[model samples]
Target chain A: MFAFFLSSGLFLGWSLGANDASNVFGTAVGSRMVKFRTAAIVCSVFVILGAVISGSGASHTLGKLGSVNAIAGAFMVAFAAAMSVYLMTLARYPVSTSQAIVGAIIGWNLFTGSRIDTNSLTKIVLTWVACPILSAVFAMIIYKLVALYIKFMKIHMFKLDSMTRYGLFFAGALGSYSLGANNIANVMGVFVPVSPFSSISFYGLFTLTSAQQLFLIGSLAIAVGVFTYSKRVMLTVGTGIFQLSPVAAFVCVVAHSIVLLLFASQGLERFLISHNIPPIPLVPVSSSQAIVGAVIGIGLLKGGRGIQWKTVAGITSGWIVTPIIAALISFISLFFLQNVFQQKTYRPVGYLITIDAAQRIRDGGVSEEKFKGLQGREFPTAVKFSNALSEYTELTREERDLIVLSAQMDEMEITRSGITGLDTNWITPEQIAALELLEGRVFDHQWQLDEALAEVSPYWRFREDDDKYNRDLRQKLSYIYRFFRYG
Target chain B: MSKGILRKQIGIEKQIDEFLDLISESGLIFKAGIGAYLNGKTDDFLRKIEQITDAEHRGDSLRRTLEERLYIQTLIPESRGDVLELLENLDSLLDQFKGAIWQFEIERPEIGPEFHEDFKEVVKYAVESVESIILSSRAFFKNIAAVADHMHKVSYWETESDKVSSNLQRAIFRRKDLSMSHRLQLRDFARQVDNIADVAEDVADRLAIYVIKRSL
Candidate 1:
């Protein structure tokens, strides 16, 4: 049953690999600087590693946007998104999995009557607009620097050709890695809420959670897609768009990779937040947009003469239309899945107003006066409860969900000592040492706590596991160290 | 048929155009050498011929480098033989310029005042013919449609050079005041000068055929 449900996510992963993977190595392979076989092999290996390691950060933000609570809902949403992308691909349009998945999630949110976190949605949309612009700026700067360096050094023709080839290979690898890290959320983010597998520990050295396992499987599907379907797409991008010099190709790939890394790197976000700088929103960005932006950047730098503005406008229209189509498809599909298939598309849960819920909402900085008339009121969904409560007091979707989750919980005593007494079997010695060092420090968010601990002991930071160990430790320590939740 | 490979082939063709430019530069130097000789500046003529020799050497090295690159890169496998043949023929045109200029520098043939204008006219026609061949060669790479016009000019200039050379040779031999050896020597110099136009016409003919093959 789980396997059947997971196939849709894998399908989406495959299509993502088929389409977006070309943006990474298309120019290199198309220009014949690197062979198609070599590019595919390198892209597959790095994409898998990236997906398994850093894929979770962007998905966490998607989860905040809307948690598709049922496995059936997740499957249908993924199917809808995949179908839209596949249909767009067949029509020879540029497909953005990011926009498709976001639209699908919104469809799910609307159908399940979940309150959409407007802040997170706004951030995602803003990044969509910013991703290509940022890539263009980065490409222009990098292209100029590389051109100046080549000019200053007066490199030989053959030597410059060899250097460009090497640079392309390196950039292609980084681009592949960034693609997997940022876009994996589009493939497996819906499944994360209803992940079927349990945490499996191997030899007490490492553990694989259900979400990571799902990501690994999706990444494999993506790798297969790259090996099989990406060749033609790569050739088109390499030669069909414009004539890209080897150096221009490298700059474009590098610029795209940097944009993906910026949006996907939780460590970078946390580093910024800790230094009193606003963090970049962790969102699944479109690799297609980034690459196009980079290409346009290089084109504009060369006086903008040869750029196919008509094609660019066409692609932009596709980007705008894809998400809306996916959303409509997901909504209609969910309706059919619920009515014809008789599947549980959403869990039927009700939230009961309790003292604990009211206190938590108050603690969240919502006014208690807003809850005056809603005492003991039973609501069918968190969205319904929050919709009523929002009339008097402004409440975000995340805070509303938190309040509803607390309201649904049975009364239980949670003491600081009791949390400390919980088993720390999975905690490493380095984490324990860092936790001790941070015994006196205060953190505004759970990630800040982990970042502070990571600063004290670098071993507390695991790059290969998506910071899972720190998250687990933070979850365990949250009982003793509670923080106010607000937008 | 692959666009990727086709684009790369265009890059190699561009390099070939640059190589033709170097050949054209050598032709111009050859013309300058003849002009200096006609002006009775023996030292200036030798110096101009030396510069023509340098241009020939540079053209030879550039042609070799281009051939090596084409062979190594295999940028245009199907047209490789035709392109190499065309380059070899074009290199021969430069060789004619170098050979004719060196002959004049070494022989230092004395010319009568009456035949000087005719000799200079032969040199002008020959140089113009080579210049037309260079334009046709460039058009072969850039604009195939323009190649025919330039090739026609090449043939017209080559014919003009032949007429001028024959008239000059007739005038030199008809001079009873000159020694037979001197007459033969002067005729040989005029024939050598006319040979440049013949070589350029041959290259232009080959280039026309190559362009037709490419367009086909």
Candidate 2:
């Protein structure tokens, strides 16, 4: 059953590999500087390495946007995203899997009546615009420096050819790695909440989290896609688009890779935050758009005569059109999967404004008069609850979202089996001991469990001053919530 | 694998340099052959002919090897065609030098004392033009920016060769004592020597275009 649900995610992974690999190695293969065989091998190996190692950072933002929360729901969301990408490709429009998946998740949110985190949505949409522009700036700078070096040093033509060949190979490898690190979220992120795999320890040497395991499988599917289907796309990108010299191709690839790394590297984010600088949001960005922007950068540097503005406008339009199509497809497909197929597409979460919840909301700065009529009333979905709140109180979207979060009724039981199944290598011994003390206790909501655990042990409490530590704490807390709720 | 590629590249670079050396050396051999013929040193003239012919053969062999390696190894793919064409043109220039010397040996025309200075002057200018073109070809490989510097000088030497060859031909036709066939034969020798510089100028013009194509 797990494999049956995971097939859709794997299909999305395969499509991502088939299309996006060309963005990295297309110019090299098309120029005949690197063989297609060599490019495929290097690309597949590095992509897997990157996905397993650094894929978690971007998925966190996707989770914030909307967690799919059920296996059948994840399947339909991935299927819708993959189908939209295929349809757009068939229609000869520039498409991005990242945008498609975001739209599909939003569709799932609408169907489940879950509140879309506006903060996460705004951050993701802003990055979609910033990504290409950043790549263009990096390309222009690197191209100018390389041109100046060639002019002053005067390298022999053959030696320069050899150097460019090596440069293309390394840049392609880096680009492939960055592509996997940043874009794997679109493939397997929807399934992360309902992943059936548990963390496995290899004799205490290392541990593979369930999310990492999912990413590994998805990346392997991507590798298969690269080997089986990417050659044609690469050839077209290499020769059909603007004719770039090998050096210019190298510059474009390096610039694209840098942009992906900036958006995906957790280590870079940590380093920036530790030094009192604002961290860049980790978001999955479109690799094709980055390539187009890099190419345009070179054209603009050469006095901007060769750019086809019509094609650029067409591609930009596809960004808006592809997402709307994916969202509609996701909404319709999820409806059929739940009703016609008789699948449990989502678990209905009920919201009730209990006295304890009302007190929490009061602490959050909402007045008692705002919820006078809603006291002790139960709503089947978050949308229903928010509508009821709007009828009685004048509240902003953020305040309404906060009330919905406080009233969410997630019944969690700390059982012996759940306690024994915890990954000891991940959850510290002290955190586990705290969980053992609370064995057999019941909590009305996720935050109730969080509060109970924090009261028992400082290890579970979040540090307000440290963002990195708090992020890891939240991840562990989320894992615990799932383990106890569905174990 | 990289070491093997580097070794192959070094071998090709050396062969190209040797090929250019053969052309430059043949130009000197042509000049010496002309001087020996004018001074009536029969034995010396024959030796120079054998030497020029040997250089031309070696240049042909080296060019063939370089061309084969370039195609087989697929090195410098973007500029391979241009480099191969340049090599063939340089080889043709070497053949022109050998052909001119062979003409002198076959025809054995009786030369007057008055024509000696003009013949020597024409040969000097022709050799100078070939030498400048050789430098430009070297720059095309090693230092592309310096190619224009040497390339412009080829036209200058070709113009000087043109001046001397036209004066020598006019001087020969103006001689009333010489037979018409003999005068025409001497004129043919003058044109043959001057043709080497003309070919050098043409090769330089092609090289200039190749440089433009390669510039980023």
Candidate 3:
């Protein structure tokens, strides 16, 4: 059953590979500076490495927006997104898989009555807008520098040709790596919450987490797509589109790679945060859009006569239209899958405000009067509960979300089997010891186990000053949350 | 792989340099051949003719080899067409030089004493024009920014050659002592030698456009 459902995500991965691979290697192959065979090999190897190593950062943001909690639901969400991409592309509308997946996830959220995290949504949308603009700026700067160097150095034409070919190969590699690191979330992120695999340890040298395993499978599908179908796309991109000199093509590829790295690199984010600077959000951005922005930058640098404003307008319209189309498809397909096909798309999560839940809400700084009437009332879904909270309380969105989180009812039991199921490669011994202490404890809410674990060991406790450690802790906590809930 | 690519580049660079050297050497040989012909040294003139004919054949062979290597390796793809056109034009300059020398050998034109210095001047100017255009073509391959520095000199020498060729033709036609056939033959030889400079100027014009197309 898991294999059957995961096929949709693999399909999405394949299509992403077939299309987006061209964005990185197209100009190189088009100009005949790099052969398609060499490009396909370098692209496949780096993409796999990037996916397994750095794929988690962007998926974290997607998980924040909405965690599609059922395998069947994840399947339909991925299927709908893939369908939207295919349908829109067939209709000659430019589309982004990133936008399509985000829309499909939101559709799942609406269907499940889960509250959408507006903050995450805003960050994602902002990155989408900033991606192309940043790429254009990088391209212009790199182009000027390269042009000046070539002029002043007085390199031979043949040497410059050789150098540009080398540059294109390296830049294509980097672009493929960034593409996999940033965009794998769109292919495998929806299945992360319901992933059936556990962390696999290899002689204590390394571990592949459940999410990493899913990413590996997804990236392999992408590699297959690159090997099988990307050659035609590459040829078309090389010759059929904008005619760029080899040097300009190299510059554009470097610029595109840099933009994708800025949006997807967790190390950069951590470095910025550690230095007391605000971090750029790790979001999956469109690789095609980045290349277009780069080409436009080169065009504008050459005095703006070469730019086709019509293509720019077409891509801009795609940003707004692709997601809406995907959302409608996702919602409609999910409805049929749940009712007509008799699949369980969601497990209804009931909300209750017990005495302990009220105490937790009070601890979060919400006034007693705000949620007074909402106490002792049970709601069948988050939508009913939020509606009740609004009727009885005058609170801000954050405060209302806090009430919903605090009052959410999730029955968890830290059983012997659950404790044994935890991978020591991921969980520290001290953290596992804490879990062992609460082995038979039953908790009515997920936060109760968190509180218990924090009390027993400082290893599980989050510190305010250490952002990196806290981020890791949050991941472990979420993983533990799902482990105990399902086990 | 990188080492292999560099080896291939070196091989092609050597071939291109060899090709350019042939053109430059032909210009020098053409000037020497014209001097020998005007001095009436039959043996030296014939030797120069053979040397020039050999140079022209070698230049043609080198050009064909270079064009084949470029297509086979797919090097400098964006500029490949331009480079091939430039090579063909440069080869034509060699043909013009060889053709003029052959004309001297065939017609054995009777030159009067007064026209000797004028003939040398026209040949000098035409050879200088070829020299300048050769420099421009080399710059186009090795240092594109320096191409402009040498390109304009081709037209300058061409104009000087035109002046010398016209004065010599007028001097030849003005002489009533020579027959109409003799005057016409001398005039045709002068024009033939001056046409080398004219072709060099046309090549410079094409090189300018190739430079622009290659500019970043």
- Candidate with top TM-score is 3
Candidate 2 lDDT (Cα, whole model)? 0.83
Candidate 3 lDDT over residue span A1-487, tens digit each = 8788889988878877777788899879878888888899999998998899988655443342236767688788888777776664444333467777778888887888876656656755775577778888989999999988988898888988988898888888887887788778778876776689999999999999888999999999989878877776665445444567899889888888788778766688889988989888666556776776777778788887766677567656766777777778889999999999999987677899889889988988988999888788889888889988877867897788788988888888888887777667778898999998988888888788888999999998989867667878888887677667742
- Scored on chain A only, each candidate's TM-score is 0.73, 0.87, 0.86
Give the proportion of true interface contacts each model preserves, from 0 to 1: 0.00, 0.46, 0.71
Model 1 segments more than 4 A misplaced:
A30-32, A35-37, A52-66, A181-216, A231-241, A262-264, A269-285, A360-369, A386-487, B1-216
Model 2: fraction of native contacts: 0.46
Interface RMSD of 1: 11.7
RMSD in order of candidates: 10.4, 3.5, 3.4
Name the lDDT value of residue A222 in candidate 2: 92
Q: What would the DockQ be for model 3?
A: 0.73
DockQ of 1: 0.08
lDDT of 1 at B138: 68
Return the lDDT, model 2, position A188.
80
Tens digit of lDDT per residue, candidate 1, span A134-177? 88899999988987786567453334555567778778888788
Docking class of 2: medium
Q: Candidate 1 versus the native: TM-score?
A: 0.64
DockQ of every model listed?
0.08, 0.55, 0.73
